[model samples]
Target: MERLQKVIAHAGVASRRKAEQLIVEGKVKVNGKVVKELGIKVGENDRVEVEGIPLEREEPVYLLLYKPSGVISAVKDDKDRKVVTDFIPYIKQRIYPVGRLDYDTSGILLLTNDGEFANALMHPRYEVEKTYVAKVKGVPSRESIKILERGVVLEDGKTAPAKVKVISFDKRKQTTILEITIHEGRNRQVRRMLEAIEHPVLKLKREQYAFLTLSGLSTGDSRELSPHEVKQLRALVLHGKNRA
Candidate 1:
């Protein structure tokens, strides 16, 4: 048995906090009866609904999207721009982005309906690494790369050690392509780090998250994770938790 709001949240109707608000607003009903109290417990036999739509059965969905530049990473954008959810319109169960990707950035993005799974991946203590390919204004010297490898001081504080690899350099454009991998999720950390060294990022794309990659995806395309992939991700999250 589970608390009514918890069951509703597991059903993907809304977040737990929002589900509690629905109950308080008299918008939740169970088995043809309105339920306004927060203390009520429910079982599998109960029929739960918000407004008039019956709650969906709990089904954890894991998706990988090749995010295209110009779309917001959130479920919705107040600025009226396209959002990540627009790609999965056929999916009825509510899902949310595991982390964030800026509007101008594009790459591998994970979304899931399982809150615990999402939390495990995003938690700072888990130290899950994210790899980004940054195209910057100039070729970085070995000393500059070493500076990044050691740590760069940002406005928030000094960054943790990062892995930096010079992928290539273009003479015509006078730009360099770099592979920078870090475990931190600070806002615009990659862009900020490059700027501090006098090289501003021209474009940024995340190439990998943990062991997951955007190998089979194209811009704006999405697909459900295979069973094997799901198992691998859960194992990684569990392993991270144990280490923490």
Candidate 2:
């Protein structure tokens, strides 16, 4: 269930504020009764109409995309750069990225039309795990690795403790591949954390989000999430879990 105004807005009737105005003006009805109250909620079975026209609610869609570097993680970009939505033109619903990925970063991304689901996953209290594999400029010292695992101070604040592991290292190139998992979703956080350790990121890619991964998907490919997967995610957030 959702607020009537929000429901109307999600149905593409009008914006939420406009929906409120229409409701107060008696232009909106639920189950054949004019509703003027803003707090009124409607469920799936509820019949809603605006200005005597039946409202058509869009069914929610959940998709996982292997977002390639350079593609904007937005509905549209002001500079007209290609966006994640452009890759899935076959989908009709106005879905959006659950969270953003940097233009220079690539990998697992989720997009959905269900605002509640997105909010639940994004809420700080949920502590949803996000894993990233990064190739950095140099091999970090044990002290730097410890600093990352213990939480590093950033411009924003001290980040929560992370799960960090050195995946591999190239002696000749002086680069190290590391896997770091964290719950926070700060902008360019992985890069910032590496910078804080004096090992700036050379390249980065998200490996996992919560339990979701880019197992079969390739770059720029996407697939609709199964009903069970969606249910599992909702349950994961609802039950809460330890911070990464």
Candidate 3:
């Protein structure tokens, strides 16, 4: 059994938060009874409806795509650009990206049809780590690195603390390659963060999300995640919530 809102979300009717709102607004029904309570739980045998539409739950699918630069992260794009879903033409489930990677940023991106799992992993409270390797224009000073480690102010607000390391320096080209790990999913965050420290990124690629990596996959390659991997990810967010 699961919370009614969770079941609604799992069916892809809405996000968990939105599902709660729908329940409160009396738009959701369980077994033909309008359910306005947020805490109600339902079993697999229970029938659910949202906005008078019966829920149809699809089997969840999880995928890791080594996204190439210049492709959209969404299932479809308004401007008709190529999207991440285009890489997996054979997948039948209606999966969406868990979070976003910038159009120009490439590497480890997760796609899933499990709405509850996606919500948990993307929730701010869970703090799922994302690691990126960036090639920036200039070598940063130790003080600048420290500033990043502490947190930097952006247009939206101050970023949370980040883990940054200088991987290499190119004296001839006057560029630096560094790795930065952050949990926030702000738009253009990695680029903006480096820009805050006066080292604009020349190229950026995400290398990891949680413990998952783009180890064997090349650009535009993808694979279904193993069951164990999915279990581990779910456990990670659950454990994170417990710790929080």
Q: Count the backbone clashes (under 3 Å) in each candidate.
A: 0, 0, 0
Error of 3 at 160 (Å): 1.2
> Each candidate's TM vs. the true structure?
0.80, 0.83, 0.94
Residue-level lDDT of model 1, residues 1-244, one tens digit each, is: 8899777766656667778998999999999999999999998888988999987776788999999999898898888899999998977778888888988999989988876567667777778899999999988888889989999988899998999989899988899999999988888889999998989999999999988899878898999998898888778878888997
Q: What local distance difference test score does each model get?
A: 0.87, 0.90, 0.92
RMSD of each: 4.1, 4.3, 1.5
In candidate 2, clashing pairs total 0
Worst 10 residues of 2 by lDDT: 9-18
Give me candidate 2's TM-score against the actual structure.
0.83
Please report the candidate that would top lDDT against the real structure. 3
Cα displacement (Å) at residue 185, model 2: 0.5
Write down the TM-score for model 1. Answer: 0.80
Query: What would the per-residue lDDT of candidate 3 be over residues 1-244, giving only the tens digit for each residue?
Result: 8898888888766788989999999998889999999888898899999999999878889999999999999999999999999999999888899989999999999998888788889887888999999999988999999999999999999999999999999989999999999998999999999999999999999999999998888899999999999999999998989989
Per-residue lDDT for 106-201 in model 2, tens only?
A: 999999877667766777688889999999998899999999999999999999999999999998999999999998899989899999888999
